[model samples]
Target: MLSRLAAPILGIPRPAKRVIVLAVDASLCVLTVWLAYYLRLGEWVKISGEGFWQPQWAVAGSLALALPIFIVNGFYRAIFRYSGLAALMTIIKAVAVYGLLYASIFTAVGLEGVPRTIGLIQPMLLLLTVGASRMLARFWLGGVYQNQLRMATLPRVLIYGAGNAGRQLAAAMANSHEMRVVGFMDDDDRLHGHVLNGLPIYSPADLPSLVSSLHIATVLLAIPSASRYRRNEMIQQMRRAHVEVRTLPSVSELAQGTVSTSDLRELDIDDLLGREPVNPNLLLLGKAIHGKVVLVTGAGGSIGSELCRQILAVGPVELVLVEQSEFALYEIHQELLGRVGEAPVILHPVLASVRDRHLMQDIMRRYRPDTVYHAAAYKHVPLVEHNPVEGIRNNTLGTLVAAEAAAAAGVADFVLISTDKAVRPTNIMGASKRLAEMTLQALSAAGSQTRYSMVRFGNVLGSSGSVVPKFRRQIQDGGPITLTHPEITRYFMTIPEAAQLVIQAGAMAKGGDVFVLDMGSPVKIRDLAVQMIELSGLCLKSPANPDGDIEIRITGLRPGEKLYEELLIGNNPSPTSHPRIMKAHEEFLPWPQLRARLDALETALDATDLDVVEALLTDLVAGFRCESDTPGWNGTATALAANHA
Candidate 1:
């Protein structure tokens, strides 16, 4: 109740607050001077002898001189409730100067009928009293002590670094009532057992004991400069302790030299993956987009949208977003415009599917984009497997239309976003993307000015088809977190990293280059689920722990889903200029042969016979294997052969 009342007084207007502080200091000056006289002169300073104001001239002069000195030294400018050591030091300096000046004047005037010793005694008394009063206000009001008052409710947190970045973070959270910082965890042996900001610095090995004793529930990673691999190692240790973990923004992301509430957020899964990104090659990144007209197909999709962002950052002359969905198109277009506000890039949003050949050609002729990043495709595996004809029509035929149009328009660069599933595929989505890659390869082989290239990587971490989000949603809904298979594993990369490598890889293209990204390592689906649940401070339900918060349920793999995904069709990839990308020399059908097969594919697709399309894909795409040899598919294959015959 008392703290609540004090809050309003502390929150008063600046000028008013200063006036109140000034008045209090002036009264304290008179009181300290009178006390000084009473202490030094026994009978003369008695109330009956001089009425405590006998030295009326001295008390009046003290106020007249000391108030101006205190005001001049910015004593009142330092808010009483928030003032610190700096303010205390300024008070001492002002009092010392006042004493010396007053003593000099009185010496020349022979004490001016006042006690000589009062001048020396008063300065010392004033310094002690005034300085102490300022600190008392800070303590009484909601300053650092406020954090102490709410320590019972606030979660005890431990900071994970003791370096410069860690210190800045500590300063920001000094008076925070939401989380009380218990101590710091550092790897440096020298810092162990030492106190930092009133909290002990513990070694990494001491975290378990400290967390247990201190009842710490959260750990904030303040090592902004730590490598991803090192940070992940620390997080794994934290997870073992069953504590929630978070992190500060990276050094580049933090405001020049400060940390704030906005700079702290939950640790990203990419950080846990421990893949330290290689710095992008700026020259290669901008080679295709800088000052050139750039067009992105499926520009509103996850990968496409990120490509637009990176392209805009590279100073493209004009950006054309070609998306089939109207809402997705408008959303991305608005987001891009807002991000690049007033920037000199001309943005054009075209709501036309890549399957529309005439529209694709018209866009090509209208903009004549120097670079076209083809990101359009039906990527959902089960959905594409169920509707193979439309999948191939949109993915394969769409790429054909866009590639042919770009070639005819003499576009300088044509880059197709391919997938790891496209390699030795079993699903229609993968096969469609493989066929798209083949189309780009064949277009380049046909001797066109457009330099066709494709960048192949595994599943992006948060794309529309990512299993991560599905598991997250299921977890949020509270129940069985479904896993397709216990052994299923796939490569993962953050959206930004994949987009960056794509632009760099595309720019390095000599001709039809199949650039494969170095998708660090494959992560098992089961392990990923377990890690996510644990890091969220939740336990998984199993035979051993039947009362866990989240339950993991396994469902049989869907059609066209594989236990593992491969990034290369063959193992003969040569390294590119960039460390994390490679160029693969895969065999592609010549335009003459591929063109005839495509024509037959169109005829088969138009017939609406699923079996004929499957047979065509199996025969045309090398290394393509059927996920199932069900008796039904065999019967359909025979029927398809009879009809073709």
Candidate 2:
């Protein structure tokens, strides 16, 4: 009934609200003065009492002092419901000043009928009444007293650390209506069983029991300084408990601000696969590109775009982006332009295929770049296996065109972005990449001004056609997570880290050097799927637990897919200046002999001779295994041959 009555008052105009509060304060002042007299005289007092210094005089004087002081101190201007400590302090200060002035005029001046004690007693009574009124208003108007009921409906969470970040995050979330922080779980034994800011600090070992007892739906990780391995362990523990987990970004990313609920992010999948990235060697990274014109082919691709971003940060004089797709080119170019901000670097966005020899030659000649990064290729294994001819034409033939153009244009350094699939090839894509590597090696061996090298690494997370994004989408859609094989494993890294390492590797390259990034231990496909499901607050739907949320489905392996990938074909990789980069000593064909075979392959490709193309690719690329009966290869080839005729 009181809340319904207060609702209309809350809806009143600001000016009317102020008038109402001012009138309330006027009445409070008069009542406090009478109460003071009644307390002093030990009897009821009336405002109509006689004399020049009567009770009526005291009421009028009190109002004159109190109302103006309250108004000037912003007492009437404050919104009562949202008022806090600062507002209360303003009240105390204003009342103290009013009390001092009232005492001087009424009591300290030695008035005959006024008692000096009433002056002191009246302000003290008024202070209590004024402060209590605001509190009561906040409770009634803001409905803050109902927070207990609201909190019960909010999702309960436990912070996974008790340090400064955890405390700050808890404080920031205190008013949040979405999630209620019930307690903290820390690894520290000393903090266990203790109370922090009225919340219990339980040991991490009790997470399973705590999740059940407290009904915790999520765990927020606040240990930003924790290593990747340590974080992965904690995440696994939460997963086993069947609670969802989110985390704060790295300490460096959190440097500029206090920990807040908005800063929480989903667990990074990359942390599950790799170790802490080593800081890039600034000198090595800036060696080839600083103050020099640079160009990157496939410039809008995952690795290619990242290379452009890092290269721009390295302060290149000019950055030319060569991409085949018009939309991809426009997107990356616009993004780079936003980051350029006052930097003198000139950006050139060119829409042209790397396979076009004349176009590539023209771009390279026009830029005469100091360094060229070749990242364009058809990388999806199954897709390339189905379209073998186009995959070979783009991956193998395109590298030859780009590298030769760079050399002919007198570009100083050329870097080809290779993959682990190129090491021991079973698929058309892998064979084509290996042949591209040979093209660069042969070019370097034939003695050109351009120094050609290749950087080979494993799968980059979040790339198009990568399992990471596919898994994320499946999880979001409440699905059956699909994998090619239960036993299959693959190496993974972040795109930015891969690009940074690629640049450093290219900078340290000598002629024909094949630099391989040291990808941490490969992660199994089944384990990855399970971890993803668990971290998403879900469980595997299997016979063992039929009530689980999502099922992990194993599809048969696709054509050209491998159970695992290798970074190097040969053994004994030598360490480079950077700890993460390794140089491999591998054999290659000389240019004269390789060129004749390449010419024959080109002729065979133009003639639509699928059988001859397969023979030449298998003969040219080491460890090449041709799947003659790969599902769609024969049908596509037949269609192409008939169309050509």
Candidate 3:
């Protein structure tokens, strides 16, 4: 019934509502001033008085002065529901101004028995009346936050902090119609059992009970300054209680260095990394990029894109982006342009394959880049194993072409982005990468001016076709997560960190240097999937939980997939200036001999002869053993021998 009566007022435009508030303030000014006179006289009503409630200029002037003063103080500009101490301060100022003006004007008019003390009492009365009026309206009429009250229909949530960020988040949630805040779950014993924002704050140990009692479906982590390990522990506890989880951005991403509703976001997969990222070495970051022309192949790929972003930030003179995919190239190019926003870095997006020798040389000569970051290659194990020919042609031959061009163009520094699988390869993809590294090693040995190096790290978290994103999508789709093997393990790093480490390693390189990055630890694929499922507030389909939301299924390993990945090619590793990067002393064939073998491999590949390709890979790659000599061809050994003959 109240809403029905207020419909007309609510239907008015927002600014028009402020006009209504202005008129209401004028009325209150007159009423409060009259009330002030009564208080000064110390009387309830003058029933038998000759001049009872006499008309006075002071009363008339009260409305005149208060209305303009309130407008000037911007009293009506605040959203009533969201108003706080700032709004109250504005009211105090307006009252003081109106009262002073009223006193001076009415006193000079000498208008009758208005005591001078009434002037002092009137302003204080005005402040109380105006402040109370807005509070009453906000509390009773549901001032713009009426929709927020509708949030009771949605899932109830408990915040996990009771400090400033948590309090602010609770208030902001009160303005959101998507979810409702039930209470706070904090770890501080001092804050336990206290009521904040009219909601109780409970200890973390009480979360399970509170969650059940309140039917809370979500737990928001408003502790932005918390370490990743602590956040993970909290999330694990909440998820174990079978409740969903959300979190705000880190402390640095908060608005004005404080939490805001806009800063609230869902938890990303990286939150599971369980520690802070390492601080990068600035001198190393600037060594290759600052004021130098840098060219990156595969500049549209995941690691490639991150390298481009970081390189652009470090004041590169010009950036040459070489990518084969049209859409991918266009996307990274447009992103760089928008992000750079007219920065002096010259962005050149080249649409050409790294395998094309002529195009590689042409661009290298045209740009005359000082540093070349070669990142192009086929990386997926299963896909590359199935299509070994294309994989070898791209990863192996592409590196040769890019390196040769860089050498011919006198590019001073060259960095090849490599992977851990290249160390002791079981798959065609890894073997191809190993050969690519050797190609660069050979080029560096040929007395080229370019200081060639390779940075080999383990799997990056969000790289294309990596397990993290694949798992995220499966979980989102109500999944039976497919794993290759129960015991498979791989090292993980963030994309930005991988790229930064690669740049740093390249900066510290001499000719033919193979730098192995310090990947933190090897995580079991099975364990990672289990942790992911648990963190998603879902139980695994095992003996304990017969009726679980998600299941992990073992799909036997692919043909070329390895049970473990290794970062080092050999035992010898020399320490570098940076702790996370190490220089490896590995042997490579001289360019004089490598060039001839490359020609033979190219010839064998062009003829579509898989037998020779397999033989060459087995003989040329160190520690590469062939499980079966099957060329995956229709012909038998006799036919293969005759064909080779």
Q: What is the TM-score of each predicted model, taking all chains together?
A: 0.75, 0.78, 0.75
RMSD of 3: 12.9
> What residue runs in model 3 are displaced by over 4 Å at the alpha carbon?
1-149, 255-262, 626-645
Candidate 2: lDDT of 232?
79
Maximum-TM-score candidate: 2
User: lDDT rank, highest first?
Assistant: 2, 1, 3
Number of clashes found in candidate 3:
0
What pairs collide in candidate 1?
A: none
All models, RMSD in angstroms? 12.4, 11.0, 12.9
Top-scoring candidate (lDDT): 2
Which tens-of-lDDT digit does each residue in 299-345 have in candidate 2? 99999999999999999999999999999999999999999999999
User: How much does candidate 3 score in TM-score?
Assistant: 0.75
Worst 10 contiguous positions by lDDT, candidate 2? 627-636
Q: How do the residues 1-645 of candidate 1 rate in per-residue lDDT, one tens digit apiece?
A: 877678677567889988998888888877787788778766436322354345666677678889999878877765753368777778778888988877765544545456677667877888888888888787777453454447768888889999888887788887776787878999999999999877889988877777789998888899988888988888898777767788987778875757875688865568778889998999999999999999999999999999999999999989999999999999999999898877799999999988898999999999999999999988998877766667889999999999989988889999999999999998888888998999889888888888999999998878996877787777778868898899999899999999999999999998889999999989998988887777666789999999898888988888888899999888899998899999987888999999999999999787766667768889888878878543225436445334434
Q: Give the range of the ten consecutive residues with the poorest summed lDDT in model 1.
A: 43-52
